[model samples]
Target: MSETPHEYPGQLIEQVRTAAAARTPLRITGGNTKAFCDEPTRGEALSTTGWAGIVSHEPSELVVTVRAGTPLAELETVLAGQGQCLPFEPPHFASGGTVGGMVAAGLAGPARASVGTVRDYVLGARFINGRGELLTFGGQVMKNVAGYDVSRALAGSRGQLGVITEVSLKVLPFAPAEATLVFELGQHDALEQLHRWGGQPLPINASCWVKDDTQASAPNLLFLRLRGAVAAVEAAGERMLREAGGTRMDNAQAGPDWALCRDQRLPFFNAPSADLCLWRLSVPQTAPVLNLPWAQLIEWHGAQRWLWAPASAAREIRAAASAVNGHATLFRAGADGAPDLARFDAPSPAIATITQRLRAEFDPSQIFGQPA
Candidate 1:
């Protein structure tokens, strides 16, 4: 029998497989806050809390290679020291989300539009396939693969693509300063504003719309934040304000607010009700007057939004998402939510097929978390 160690279980991969080989259903966890995810299965629950550390950091080369278990906060801290960061700017779950969990889940925040998505920044990875054997693919260099690179396939495959052991990513130097532009607009106009600004070649990094279910005055608050060199960020901010009319918020608080907005990991940390639903909504900005059916807390220039509804409201949320040519998912169904409502989005056909094939390639034995 494999012994689990204190503080951390070093041979986490082995421990996970041991459970799987026994035909025991395994639930993978990190931070364990989003544990309510609708996916099903049971037997032994495994934690990667012990597998934490940074293997290497090449700030000058704009690369940071680390153990899968490292906390995103820690990694970001180190990157900030060097004025560098994960360009995609993924969200750190309120319960202290880990880097490994970040990659396995392929989550990104507001910076996605301008900087690129999580899959874009991943350069390489080390993981244990379903067979319990360690595997490595891609490398330190970006644009290394000429064809299918297994390194990136791990993104969004969930934990079904074996357990990721190490991660290598391409980072970027941080700008000297940044500023945010906040404005209130109706849902109908917000869609227009998003389309207008998203089209310009501005240096905007993150844009979002905050919507209230009641559709109060300026029901949707549109926020645009631009960053770069001190002069550059300010210049872009000024130009954007001139081009787009909006009230500006003190950017000093923008960092924390951005974190809270993207992951709902903050401000909503202790929401008043356990019945709150957090969703990631994707829709077309060009679409005219989107008839958003449910109550939503939107973010990321309306590209990504959160739907707050009753646990039984998932079917409607899914339908609304479909109408917008987008999708919604339940990372947290609410305080008292349903298990089946956990999965909120139906990926595009291409993404769906790719996700499935990746599961097969990485976990041929079909032993990870579930059948991909």
Candidate 2:
């Protein structure tokens, strides 16, 4: 490969072609903000940051096509200027987080429970498979389609299947009004309220409930953010405050507070001890609050839960999640001599077989990360 800067897709294609010819594994990297999320990979680094730029954006059409390496903050800023945004509200774990990493990580912010996830907004993508073949999937719009939508499949593939070169995403107009409310409630009460509101036409856009470890007698604070038409937001805010006994929190505090939760920078995430492991549980939205021997922070209305517990509790945690028809992942672990626990849950036999087939089809040489 030439040492000269290669900033275009054609150059990236040729680079991959050479790597494929040499049977050399290429580790896809973008802003490198999410490298801690996955296990350390073995391969030559193929930095995608060099190929960054917005390819095409039609705000009038509510679609934007951007290179995979484009920084997520830049993309969001551009959309904000146009009064449009990516409804998924992908989190930027770091200042340099990239669009490719966002999709690969497959994480969404508070609004996920209401609007949808990162994969749902994915309209199309162009990527280079293990064989160095460039392929395009789906399109810019959500038109009727048949068969599989490969673009969405690649959203959370984590560079195991291919190197995403460019992506086209569906955007939404900014809400006309927004408000945040804070309720002093217990875990059970907060969970019940979230579930009840889920069945209604409430304009709730995001929520977070966390216990205050500092004050043993202090009640858990439940933060609810409502967004939509001005009238709807006002109406919902009034109803929630009157019925739920919540006070209207300053809107100014919403952005930074949400950012902390989204990026795992909240005080709850700060480990009291280096040996403690951070676990993420994905259960049904209506699943009852877990009775565990660890502190918990509830997000995504109720589907996403975070637990700060010792690494030894991995089995028990996983079992508890399984009981609720959910899965648990070791979101973060210490480098100290911790036992090796599966980062993700084991798939069912049918899913395992299909995953293997997909890996075989996209990366026959096993040049990417471990299959499935």
TM-score of each model, paired residue for residue: 0.86, 0.95
For each candidate, the alpha-carbon lDDT, in order, equals 0.70, 0.84
The sequence of per-residue lDDT tens digits that candidate 2 reaches over residues 218-245 is: 6799999899999999999999899999
Worst 10 residues of 2 by lDDT: 1-10
Candidate 1, residues 97-201, lDDT tens digits: the string is 888888877878788877778888888888777666777888888767733267877787677777787788889998777788877677667767777767776
Estimate the overall C-alpha local distance difference test score of candidate 2: 0.84
Superposed model 2: Cα runs more than 4 Å off: 1-7, 144-148, 337-339, 370-372
Give per-residue lDDT, candidate 1, residue 368: 64
> Candidate 1: minimum summed lDDT over ten consecutive residues — where?
1-10
Q: Give each prediction's root-mean-square deviation over alpha carbons.
A: 4.0, 2.8
Best by lDDT: 2
Instruction: Assess the local accuracy of residue 150 in candidate 1 as a C-alpha lDDT between 0 and 100.
Output: 78
